[model samples]
Target: MSGQQHILEFRFLAEPTDVNFGGKVHGGAVLKWIDQAAYACAVAWSGKYCVTAAMGGIQFVAPILIGDFVQVRCRLVHTGTSSMNLIVDVRARDLKAVRDRLATQCVLTFVALDAPDGKPTPVPKWIPESEEDMALARYAEKVMEVHRRIDQEVSDLRPAGQDH
Candidate 1:
């Protein structure tokens, strides 16, 4: 664990129960892990409970088979008055290999909430220091715009006062 508390990593085994019909870990299962890891990072950085406002560009490059070791790594890349952006990377390692390979990656936006009423609340500012941190922040910014556009497009597809 880093003393700065900017990043967090969680490891889990891809269980048989998580497998899809094709015999690989379900993409939704991996997404759930991503959300959990990002929430952990947001809660740690904001020191408050958080809600996922949006997710950006989840790219599943490789498959995670059952019995493989799954690692979800999350880091705080950017912050606003009440919104926090996190970059989450998922990797999987076979039983025999020590090194993990990238399986999925995405950026997510979370909103810190006041505990009593679950209202939006401000969070501590996160200033990127390292080059990697800066790059990730920039990437998050770009992805956020794309996410917003996609959300708008989806909303346009839905009728007024109706949920999709």
Candidate 2:
């Protein structure tokens, strides 16, 4: 598959079961959707099994209310010899409103693997070709620093052998 072809969009209505007791859709539900969409993209791009290496920058900008239409969009923004960086966005739209608000956003890294031995396998190189693609690529590249900082902060919060 071509690099640009690594895109998948899924639309679903947030049912009552998806919400918490507070009446808002749970963040974990949206995160599961993000992972599902990202996995789809990775599999399509690599034509092989893929595993989630990392998922970061999961910012829940807004709450998704029950009865809202939710859209999960995933697109490949960058790639390495055996890895891929995908931008995943979850948006929510009111049943009666005209605009869809950004509910959640995250970046995921996936590593393609051989099905039989579960070894890392090569994937097609994805080169950003347009301004928007370039911007996404830059964001994918720059977000690593923030992820490292978050990891360090959490590590610092835990004592040497108390890490849980």
Candidate 3:
């Protein structure tokens, strides 16, 4: 909405189907919304088809109830040669409420692909302008570092000459 292609926001009413047996919106449903929002932001920023590469730091802080207003905000925080990292925040508010409560938050990585060959393709670089943008980019970098460490640990655990 601000002419920034790197950001996307979705707002919708929570449906009864989104509720779990506990009378709140289910975790899986919230994750689906996060993915959808992140995917849209990735595609918008890259101007190409994008696939989710990884998801990390998922935190479900609160539960969304049926009939609440749900909003998912996704913004590009960092970009690699072919991958874009997005910070997705999901919030919910009762219809009569004045403020929204954070329901979930996570970082998602998406990779752009060439249309013909389906290979990873470079996406346009994003430059941070404001302090908030810079901070978010730094947070994304930290998340990537964590992912790298985990991957390395997993690889180290695997038997030599065996790639799984």
Candidate 4:
């Protein structure tokens, strides 16, 4: 996505400590990178402290071996009253192959927090100005639909009077 608003790009080199015995980066390590990237994007868009509410559709597509340089590109996909959806794409640069491959991808939901009580706080509405931005918003809407269905199924399975 090309725009002035999409603002979080972080780069780091994968060291031996970030990898596992199989010579690939650990799954948890990649998850941590995703969370950090998403958090930065949310905070930049909301201009407030944000905490992770949920994460969805995290899939590791390829292995990132040690010594590879990884880059995480994060963008704000949508915003609610107090929550925002951030999509992060992780890519590993293979110096040997002279190419970069997508390692993992995830959509992270974050809620702005009030400093006083750490409760949810209001955030600005996300206005999509371009076609690319609108496309991301549409994708986020689909993710929300899936989340809604999961919540509904869980509620339907609850015992009577214990529906919470």
- CA-lDDT, candidates in order: 0.91, 0.90, 0.91, 0.85
**Residue 30 C-alpha lDDT in model 4:** 93
Error of 4 at 107 (Å): 1.0
Q: Give the better candidate number (1 or 2) by lDDT.
A: 1
Q: RMSD of each candidate?
A: 2.2, 2.1, 2.3, 3.3
Better of 2 and 3 by lDDT: 3
Arrange candidates, best TM-score first.
Answer: 1, 3, 2, 4
* Residue pairs with backbone atoms closer than 3 Å in model 4 (clashes): none
Given candidate 1, what's the lDDT at residue 122? 89
Give the 10-residue window scoring lowest on summed lDDT in candidate 3: 1-10
Candidate 2 global lDDT = 0.90
Task: Please give, for residues 36-75, the per-residue lDDT of candidate 2 as tens digits.
Answer: 9999999899888999988887899999999999999999
Which ten-residue region of model 4 has the weakest summed lDDT? 1-10
lDDT (Cα, 0-100) at 23 in candidate 3:
96
Query: How would you encode candidate 3's per-residue C-alpha lDDT over 1-164 as one tens digit per residue?
Result: 21259889999999999999999998999999999999999988998899999888889999999999999999999988999999999999999989999999989999999999999999998989899999999998888789878988999999999896
Record all residue pairs in model 2 with backbone atoms less than 3 Å apart, i.e. clashing: none
lDDT (Cα, tens digit) per residue for candidate 1, span 1-164: 21257789999899999999999999999999999999998888888889999999899999999999989999899999999999999999997998889999999999999989999998888888899889889999999999999988999999899986
The parts of candidate 2 lying over 4 Å away from their true place are 1-4, 152-164
